[model samples]
Target: MLAKRINGALRHVPAWPLYIVAVVPPVWLLWQGLTGGLGVEPIKALEHELGELALQLLIAGLCITPLRRFAGVNLLRYRRAVGLIAFFYVVLHLLVWLVLDVQILSQIWADIIKRPYITVGMAAFVLLIPLAATSNNASIRKLGGKRWRQLHKLVYAAALLGGVHFLMLVKGFQIEPLIYLAIIVGLLALRLPLATGARQRA
Candidate 1:
């Protein structure tokens, strides 16, 4: 009953407001970086925060399917907004690395080629571009349901790559990155055919 009520209320809540709310953290991080509040390596701090935020948002979007299936909580309406917000942060993260950290175009290319984490991160970002571009009703209509869904499956790859990128970028067996990787793996496990089939038939 409580879930029903929450779902009903969500029907009236506009997704635009959520987008506005989602923009706050990145802006705040930027402001803090500009004001020396991000400690010694502000650029690195800002980049890390933006990438983490993107990962968090992607995980949140991934949760929508399981939430509706098991918890009776529906958030399908906000999934697109969540995804776009994730993509936006990803763009910011890449920009910071390219323009602020590396600055030199040749060095950026060299880093992407030499650094395994950067290569993985770039691949994940590249996968996300088509997904972000086709996230609309028009694209849905044009591509049809099955094809669109198949295309969006790129997200699973992106998520796994993102997790691996983060893990490798940390360069150690840090608990936090390990935890995030575990969560991503768990989420993927939940989406396996057996689990999804059982949930659907339930």
Candidate 2:
């Protein structure tokens, strides 16, 4: 009943408002970073925050389908905005690493090639490119729904890579990264049709 009410209310809500609100956090983070509020390692702090936000948004976007299917909470209207915001943060995170953390072009390329985490992160970002680019009605009409969905399925790969990247980037046995990895794995598992098949067989 509560889900129905929320879903009904959401139908009237515009996605543009969400986009406007979403821009605030990154702007605030940038201000804080510039004003020395991020402490001694401001660049690293800013990069970590942006990367984490991106991952969280990606996870939230992934949750939409599951929420509608399992809990009857429809949020299809905002999924595009959530995905675009996730990509925006991802781009910002990459920029901060490239411009602030590793200013040298050769060193940046070397890190991407030499570091495993950086390699995975770069791969995830690359996968997001097509999805972000084609997120429009015109692209949908041009490519057709089936092809568009297939292309967007790359999101699962990107999400998995993102989880691994986060896990590997943190030093030692950190519980936070492990938790994020576990959440990503759980969400992916929920999307599998195996459970339904097994239940039917039983």
Clashing pairs in 1: none
In order, the Cα lDDT scores of the candidates are 0.91, 0.92
Instruction: Give TM-scores for every candidate, taking all chains together and pairing residue i with residue i.
Output: 0.95, 0.95
Error of 1 at 65 (Å): 0.2
Model 2, stretches more than 4 Å misplaced? 196-202
lDDT of 2 at 7: 88
Error of 1 at 180 (Å): 0.7
- Write one digit per residue (lDDT tens) for candidate 2, span 9-106: 88888899988998999999999999999997899999999999999999999898888877899998899999999999999999999999999999
In angstroms, the error of model 1 at 80 is 0.3
So what's the TM-score on candidate 1? 0.95
Candidate 2, lDDT over the whole model: 0.92
Model 1 collision count: 0
